[model samples]
Structure formats: structure tokens, C-alpha cells
Target: MRVGDVFLKVDADQARIEVEAMALAPVPTPKVLWRKPPVLAIAAVPGTALGRLGEPSTASPAAWAAAGAAIRKLHDAPLPPWPGRGLDELAADLDGECEWLVTNGVLPADLVTRNRQVAEAALRPWTPVFTHGTDVDLDVIRAWSSLRSLLGVRWLVEHGFDPTAPGCEVDVLRSRM
Candidate 1:
């Protein structure tokens, strides 16, 4: 939840972990592996997760735009280096099936909650989509890039790759206003 801290979801054996990522708008944070070989990504969003909340109109347009810009800058930070598992790689390592759900035997409710959470995450930024003067720009990309970097970082840590070395901290997380 801090500026550069990464969140994730790891399995029981810790073999496969999924980063919490937004798949476009109004979508719950899903497990998306950024790389192929290592299947690394940001840690799955913390359970009971809720990204930026509230609607744009609740704040002034300028404030909303500024908030959006800040989020972009956060996502654009450079990722730390690590040994990671790509999505498929993790699946393969886990034998192509995750026992995370079955192990708990509450998969049905879990799936439902996952769907709702995805919707919440997607709704975070898209609230302005249907409003007047809603527009997207490079800042959006930067936000996403920042998110990707976090994913990369989570991968590194989950796999025992340390990124705390000097000059190894996250980059690209600049200011908005």
C-alpha cells in the first residue's frame, strides 16, 4: 500500500504467485504474469483489496486529473530485478492447476468475490469514462507501466531475488502536480 511496496497472492507451496493487476477498466485485479519465462508479476492484490475509491465528480476536475496523473507516475516506476515465473511457467510448475481454491474448498464463493473485486478495480479509473470531458493520455500509460514494474518487483522477491541493493530501488514514480 505504500508508494513502492508490491502486493501479491502466492500458493501454499509458494510455487505460483499471481500479481494483482487491472485488466482494463472496472475489472477486478486479476493474476496476470508480465513475463513469460519467469511468470513474474506484482503480488496478487491484498485480500479485501480496494484501489482508489470515489467518483471524479466528487472532486474537482483538476483534482481528479491530478489524482489520475499521480497514479500514472506511480505505475511508471522502474522495476527491480528478480527471478520470476511467467503465468504459464507458474502453471506448469504447479502442474497447470492451482490447488489454492480446492485446498480451501470454498472456490465458489471465492470466484464470486473475485468477480466483484475485478469489477471494483476496473471501476476505479473508469468512473470518469462516461462523464463530460473525460479523456485519456500518456499518463495512463505511465500508471500502467508503474503497475508493471511493481509486478516485476513482486516476482523478484517471491523467487528470492533481492532488489534492495544500492541503485536498485524503484524508479519512474515521480510527482503529479
Candidate 2:
């Protein structure tokens, strides 16, 4: 991976060495203003495995329901140093960001009302789950939502609903569901 011409060459010799990459640059001299902070590129994977069901087979309804149950079980499976402090701090940080969003005219002024609700929601703490890897297991909610949305997409394409248009298969699928 190359970031601004700094090529990252990974090989077996260096596999056990470096764990992270930091950009080499001169630090800014108190230059921050009303601009939003940068978000690092998370080449992101789908939060959950539920979306990997590439196709819906010609199986009974019970089969699909069973798959959903299995996915829930997979997510519930436990794994270690549950970072309590980090989670709380992160939630508070997100609340502050929402405030900044409002302050910087990020969106319509009237939307501040909704943003406040979201801010409150963001400030709420969550129970952390144990899983592999050291980094925070963030985005628990968003992951589930993404998975559920994928399932909906799967259903739509299964019987054939032109998600972009009209189709009899889609109508039949919706009616039966």
C-alpha cells in the first residue's frame, strides 16, 4: 500500500516487526479552524458475515429462517480485554462531534433537533462483545443494520423484484412475505 509515494512493501522477513504505519510529515502549527477532522480510510469489510449469502436456493421458508438464526449465533459467540474506558470515551467523543457538526453548519439548521436526538443516542454507552483482533470492535449497530439490509436485498433479488423497477416475481415475493 502506497500513501503519498511511501510504498509499503510487506514480506515474510518483516512480518513479525511493524504492526502499524504512520505518515511522516511536519506537524501543523495551531492551524485548526472550523473544518472537520479527517477520517482515516478503513478499507472496510462488511461488519457481519450475514451478507455473504450470495444466493437464495429453491429451499423451504424454514431454511432461510434457520440461516438467520445461525448468523445471530455466530455474532453472539464470545472471545477477551473488553475495553470499557475506550467505549465510553468514544461515545462521548462522538457526542462532541455531533455538536461540532451543528456548530459548523454541516447541515440544515432545522436538522439540529434530529442531530440532538442522535447526539443523545451517541452518548449512550454499550456493552462490548469479545472477539478476535486487538482493535476496538466498533460499529456493532451499523454492522447488524448492514447485514439486515443485505438480507432484504437478497430477498428482493431472490424471487426477482427489480429493486430499481417493477416485476411480477417481486410482487409475488412481497405478497407472500
Candidate 3:
């Protein structure tokens, strides 16, 4: 995806998964313009990112709360059709990665084993939700804010107005659930 002078490369399969997941999301997402295997075109939604790792947020408190609310809506939605892993599966994957790292000499065997033991202790059950498996950073927060802004965008669609308008568009999405 191109944002001004920067071109962001997305994995084809990952992008496809994200698009499919977004279809069921309660929050707003970038409009998919076209998809051609490795290349997917999407309309850029308005609004800057929430904040950088070490930077202060310029967005209002309400925007932050709205983002949280949006997250709650998503969490409350139905789980995807895929079966999530159990704790044992997670432990096996971790052990496998640690073994690979040690075999490749990426890390000392003792260190990997120690970390793996510690990590295994923390393994437990977790509720699965639709996630991009990426850290929630500035860009993520911005996207959430943009989604909050677009929640009511269905009204614009119903009124025959350009729903993508950055200005002069008021959306009011009323969730049935």
C-alpha cells in the first residue's frame, strides 16, 4: 500500500486474511479497491496515527475511549471459524522455536532452554479475537480512531452521500447486538 511517498508491502496471504477478517469487524477498515495476488489496492482512511512509541498522543480523550469501545465491540463478536491453539500446542511451538534457534547457533543452548522454561510457566488459556498479530502502535491507534469516526458512516451510505468524505460526514452506526 502506498501512503504518499512511502510504499508499504503486505504479504499476499496475510492481506487476504486481513481483508476477510475486516469483513466481519465492527470497526471501520480501509476500503479494498482491488486485489491482484501480491498487490492489494485500498483507499487510505483519513486521520493521523494515535502516537509513536515514545511520543505523546495528540488525539482527544474521547477518541481514545472510542477506540477502546470499538475494541470491545470486536471482542464481543463471534469467534472466527478457525480453531485456536491450546496451551500444549503453544508450548510445543515455543519448544520447537527454541530448539531451532539453538541448532542454528542463534543463541546459547542454556539461555534458550532457561527462557523456554520460564515462558512455559506463563503459558495459560486466552480468549482469541481477530488480531493482525502486530503490535498496537501509532498507526494502529490511528486506524482505530478512523474506524470510530466511520462507525456511523452507514448513515451516509443510506442517505446517498459519499461515505468516504473526510469532512462534512457524520456517521451513526447503531449496533444491533
Candidate 4:
């Protein structure tokens, strides 16, 4: 929620993480105005959002490249004190979500199966970094994208987003298949 120039973020654990991450991140992040338990007030940063999930990005190629470079810098930063999700945990969650998607007919069985197979490549050992959960491998990246789309479909629908929109998650999965 926005209050004047400050945005108030609610959520205790996430707020804490955001505070720490902002401090550690090499890229520019919103300046923390203040913090009070579940409430974190941050000064608004400059620039508009890149785009929505299902929409075409209006950002220039140079902007995208700059974003990529910033991500690279973040990944190169020292790992945070907290541990990220383990491979076994991530794999289990992916499998469960895929099963749910297929069994509930949210996505095609074949598409889910194929995405599951592709996601297997990402279920390997890797060095930890200060990232918001992304990997370097192209296949692994695609796999995560598929999994995120699958997992997000229900929430998106609940929030009145059309997952079946032309450039949306469903289209992304179909294109991969």
C-alpha cells in the first residue's frame, strides 16, 4: 500500500527478507524508510514496472540488457545467510504441482509430463547465490518458467487474471510442447 512517497509492505518474514536483500543486493532497490514488525515502509524507486506477466514488454532492448547485467551482478554477490530451497524439496513440489495440474485437468497430461521431464534437468546440485530463485541453464530456466506458470494458474484465476490469454502462461506451456 502506498502512503505518500512511501510504500508499506505487510508481512513479517517477507519484510525481513526484503530488508536484508535490499541491503545486500548490488542492484538498486527501494530505500527503506522505516520498519515496524509486519510493516515495512520504503521510499518509491524511480522507473515504471517492466511489464505484466501475460503482456508484451515495452522496455527497450537496452533496458532488458541492463536488467540482465544487474541480475548477473546479483548472482555474483555473496550468498545470504539464509538457505534457499533444497533440490529434493523443489523437485517434490514440482512433481506435486504437476500432478495436481494434470489430475484436475488444469493443463494437458502430455504437457505436464513433458514439462516435468524438462524440469528434471534443473533438479541437480548447484552452488547457492543471492537470487530470487533462478538458474543459469537455459533448459533449467524453461523448466522453472513452466513450473511457475503451472503453480500460478490457480492463483491468477482467483485474482481475475486470464491464464489462457494469448501471451499468458497457458500459451507459454503450449508453445514449449
Whole-model Cα lDDT per candidate? 0.36, 0.34, 0.49, 0.71
For model 3, state the Cα shift of residue 130 in Å.
Answer: 4.9
Off by over 4 Å in 4: 1-23, 30-65, 132-136, 158-160
For model 2, residues 57-97, the per-residue Cα lDDT tens digits are: 56556766765554454345552222233546544544554
By lDDT: ranked, best first: 4, 3, 1, 2
Estimate the overall C-alpha local distance difference test score of candidate 4. 0.71
Count of residue pairs whose backbone atoms collide, per candidate:
28, 0, 3, 0
Q: The CA-based lDDT of model 1 is what?
A: 0.36
lDDT of 3 by residue, 1-177 (tens): 244533232332332335576787878877877665544567766777675433578988888877777777776777667665466755565556556656766445664554454453335454466653234444434333333323223333444545333322121111100
Is 2 or 3 the stronger prediction by TM-score?
Answer: 3
Model 2 segments more than 4 A misplaced? 1-67, 84-88, 130-177
List clashing residue pairs in candidate 4: none
Lowest summed lDDT window (length 10), candidate 2: 21-30
lDDT, residue 64, model 2: 67
Candidate 1 local lDDT, 1-177, one digit each (tens): 222445333333333232322333232343553534444345454443222322223445676665565456434533323343444443243321223323444234443233323223222333232112224555444443333333344444556755343322133221111
TM-score of each: 0.27, 0.33, 0.46, 0.64
- Clashing pairs in model 2, backbone N/Cα/C closer than 3 A: none
Question: Which rank order by TM-score, best down to worst?
Answer: 4, 3, 2, 1
Worst 10 residues of 1 by lDDT: 168-177
Which candidate comes out best when scored by lDDT?
A: 4
